[model samples]
Target: MPTSPTTVLIVGSGPTGLTLAIELARRAVDVRIIDKTPGFPRSSRAKGPNPRSLEVLEDLGVVGEVLAASSAPLPMRKYRNGVPIADAAPFADARPTPDAPYDRPRMIAQWRLEEILRARLAEYGVRVELGSELVGLAEGRTSVTAALAGGGEIEARYVAGCDGGHSAVRKLLGVPFEGKTDETQMMVCGDVEAEGPDRGFWHQWFDEDGAVMLCPIPGTRSGWWFQAGPETDASGAPVPPSLDSFRRLFAKHTRLPGSGLSDATLLSTYRVNERLAERYRVGRVFLAGDAAHVHSIAGGLGMNTGIQDAYNLGWKLARVASGRADPALLDTYEEERLPIAADALDLSAERLRATMEAIRKPGGGLDSAVSERTNGLGGGYRRSSLATGGGTGRLRAGDRAPDAPCRDLATGTPRRLFEAFAGPHFTLLGFGPGTAQALREAAGAHDGELRAYGVDVGGPHGLADDGGHARTAYGIGPDEDLLVLVRPDNHVALIIPPGDLGAVGAYLNGAALERA
Candidate 1:
């Protein structure tokens, strides 16, 4: 078969692949994405998107649409013997604030999230090619040739494997996926309709046998996600999940009448398995999302982590393919994200164990600490290559840059500090007047690779007299002046004081600066 040429090719149309395509398209990179599935699945696997995931979606300009379609501040209800025991809306106080407005997870079904992402991708005039599966991969010095199931081939400067756990790309690369599958804990999951309960709260019932969890499926009438411990036969063989099986399990565990439940769809039995690829990239072929790592479903971080992986790689891939930066810049993708995946694996596994243990202890509720952290807000890349050190009272790199309302000197319109951090560009934020010249010089030196913005240190639009939200976000004192360099990923790349202009230039020119 003849090889079709493209700048970048991505396999799988899941959140990870679609996010990569959207990011690359926003940067005007010519890219194509292929998936084996004919269309999106209607089942709700991942219940919601976390705060960190929301930030990434916000950058794609689809957070508003997602928010509108999502249900948030979901009250977690615990029931015993078909009677409500405790009901607590954990994030009832959560509101959208400047630093981290998405204080709680938005309970939107994974299918609906994909729909919103597809709509955003459509805005860039790109559609996912369905029924095209990756069958083979051959790499050369400059490009990768991928064989398609459609009896064709595609040649692209780079290929990313966003395909799920049983990734053919990972298999083709001959990398070892090391992990263990928990045979002890098996789950039967399906989407079903319940006539007796209102679709408002997520309910969990715990007893000596096991626990059954049910959460409302957002945007679906009478739809809910049902998960329960598996039932094994006399031979120890696992019973397959079906509508009848789900009905029976719910009736036995939660004591809810099974007759009221109907229309169970997409039933499947699964065992929680944790795994991570030994490597994220090999030559020109790369992996992201489930292809790279898989973990327990306790936190729902599996899909969110994959979305973040694509967000981190999208701009870097665009730059390298466009010949703007050195290909070595791609190495940082794994360096920054691999450890994060490792942390996520450990955290989720721990949460699963803790939740199980809690069920065994009397008067034990879900650990509030574990529940809050599992939401993905507390995860950070403090040890990434882009991070720099700081002492007490100093802003450090690798921390999320703070946002404050500021006026754009050019347009005289009020905007948040995050506005300057938008787009795939290096942003130099000046804390005072002197850094303006430094920013100008750096912009000239880096040319197309950097963008500079100046934030004055006076008045209502400037840093507050007492160093308020902006000060805390940027970690600057009211009297101190400095320049903060933010990467396209919205991470603080470097914090430069008055004398560090030259250092900033060298840093931008170094490998840390992504291509294009």
Candidate 2:
């Protein structure tokens, strides 16, 4: 055991914790991350990363590695007695446009994704401190002292609980994790090598008795993920998961031969539960990922939501610890993320119920109605303190700022609007003439914190006119010449329609811009 001091200490080295570590470290914030597990697990639990998650990964500079290790969207097929009943490719129908690069989700194992994140964190000269369990915590006005299992201690200005379900940190804080545990919907999941199916697609078989699903594991020969509704024994206890038990269940449901499936690994039975912490923050201790929320595995939002939570909190924590922003900014972590978690809980529970109800019917198709809300691109904080001005037509405060190909003017080189928005600063995209001076003046006032770009009106270097794609993307109308201020998270904070430079300044400095 080793004692240490850090500005921010992250508990649990899962995706969320690792992400926060990388984000804070990128800003030169001293961060320490620890996990109870000695090493990364080799399980194929989470399906893959969503589009919005891809954006976050891109921000961390590891999107390329994740994409390279993942498989593209394959058609999901629902079957009856080994025959295809219904099939659909959600992403194929909703093809990705330039505006949204990852319109579809990728299929990759959770362990592989964690590996990529760990690698990225290594680039920052920080690695996960394994075998370090957080047993207790004490917080003061200025710092938090975390008690370790091996009698060591860490003093951190802030502590984040990225620990998964049944988080020790959450328990030590005495936060009520209120939710229901559905005992009836028990599921057995595992990674296995099987010969029964050559579907080359994710297959789900549902009938009167139960359901069995199989999805291919990317980059593994004859490897697949098996999930089946649980079967109770004579005493009504869930039959423990095993290769033999899985084969027997598959045989009973799909009439598939038991001999075809073999080499079972990482088998575990999970009960569907929906729970959320009463509060995200308790003094200097905070919660993220599964520590804050847990829900049904319907839309595969579990890991993605956690990653996004860390993304939302990382920069703010960095800003506050670095003395750039006041501690009041920390409150926004709960204000913005808690609502999203609540919504996710409702959505995941609904999706699980809908799927179960659909299975009860004779010819019910898969309920693809699971809200794409967790698609990363759709989540925003328009209600935060930073948002200003409400316009009916375009330029709303709560929209995802659009990206476009624009010239640097001085450099005469083609660059995307997102490229300019890449750094950790507030970006002002002005799309009208006679405002260059205003943009320059705002940039000068904020110095390095604010950057303004002036786009010529009715010029080729400006927005494309095809349906005002760029304007609509930025939430500004074709006729409206506006200055759109984008937050560091790529969300629109304020939209000034031509005549409100003073209002933008007020929004930035005043309470109009919340800490989150």
Candidate 3:
């Protein structure tokens, strides 16, 4: 509600908005974040961060806390007639690699993850403004004015609609959100305390009449995440989700007493609704997270995709907002994330169908949903305009910048490639000594925006690829002269011959600079 203009206005304080706010603030950009609710929701709603998201969290500097507070996904113990029949650990084989670390998803509650992000955001002297709802929005050529519920108005350079499903900002832009809702795939989910199952394994009881699943919440003693296949009447209409109905279904499916389940709060019903926005951007306003797309909850991709969307947009928004790059740089956010969301929609639906099929068979479980195969590691923007030169070397533009173990030339100690790429700056990893002068010159020309490092290159004190791991990971020979420009989000923005420094500058300039 301050009279001064904000650089970015983020609507919704969920994972999406929180991630964006942290990204912009860490870059020293002025950002304002708001949520409609008066207080933070405490529900253990979504499962937790996937493998790729853990990398994002590491970049954000909160993975240690997440790992301390969370646990790995537990094996699902299947039961028939209240007797244990099978144990399935789909993600057990997921392990860390030098290129892609943090192999599996953690099992923290959604509320706990948000709390950690909020604490990290506070380190930057910013806090979420709760109870502030957008009532009206006015957009102009280069700025947006958002009117809140309490007769307050805010002016921002850009408005990001991280608000979920029914987004007010998306509505103001009049963009169409298209998808289908399958009522037949209904579920009732909640957080509760039950006396039925051990805390080590996720318990699932299946019967001809009904089904119930109880998974222990990582940080709670008596608390468990409860999910149930909906109970139906003779006509097959789902009995509405309620306490008594949930109890009846649990008792009917399992041999455990109905009275054992208690404190069943934060209960809700969900139908499998798959939808994507027609477009992510409408002039000065952009939609992200569930605002831009919603998919079946299979594969645990719902919150993870939104977090990925925020990460992809955060660095671009910061660069453009800080005037280091052209606003056209922002267009690539949609170009990159929309296809990922569309593909995730299909992946989630396919996994959901497979899960349902498995539930009907003996020794069947949701292995496909929990596999690293469905994780977001394989996504990139190779086809975008920014990718050039046939993606030379083993690493190509539009591909993920792989990490490796190396030596700090200055200290003669072990270091990680990710350690150098940790902050909110573009990284240029140059191979061979001939590119050293250009790397240093480019770093000086861009000031602090671009950081340059020489790998296995001869200099007084340049980084040494002691094991040749960096060269192997980057797919470069010892004598090759390659310049790999890594975007702030750790994607290879441009992989060019060492002399093409102008190409790097032009890529950052974007169309916005030419128009100016």
Q: Give all candidates' CA lDDT scores.
A: 0.78, 0.79, 0.85
Per-candidate TM-scores read: 0.93, 0.92, 0.95
Clashes of 2: 6
Could you tell me how far off, in angstroms, the CA of residue 137 lies in candidate 1 after the best superposition? 0.5
Tens digits of lDDT, candidate 3, 114-215 = 999999999999899999999888887778899998899989999999999989988888899999999877889888888747899988887665689888
Model 3 residue 420 lDDT?
Answer: 85
Q: Write the per-residue lDDT of candidate 1 for residues 295-369, one digit (tens) a residue.
A: 888777899999999988998888777787677878889988899899989988988887777667443434332
Which pairs of residues have clashing backbones in candidate 1? Answer: 97-101, 319-515, 324-516, 325-515, 402-473
* lDDT by residue for model 2 (464-498), tens: 23434465556554555777788777778777765
Please, what's the RMSD in Å of model 1?
A: 2.8
Name the candidate that leads on lDDT. 3
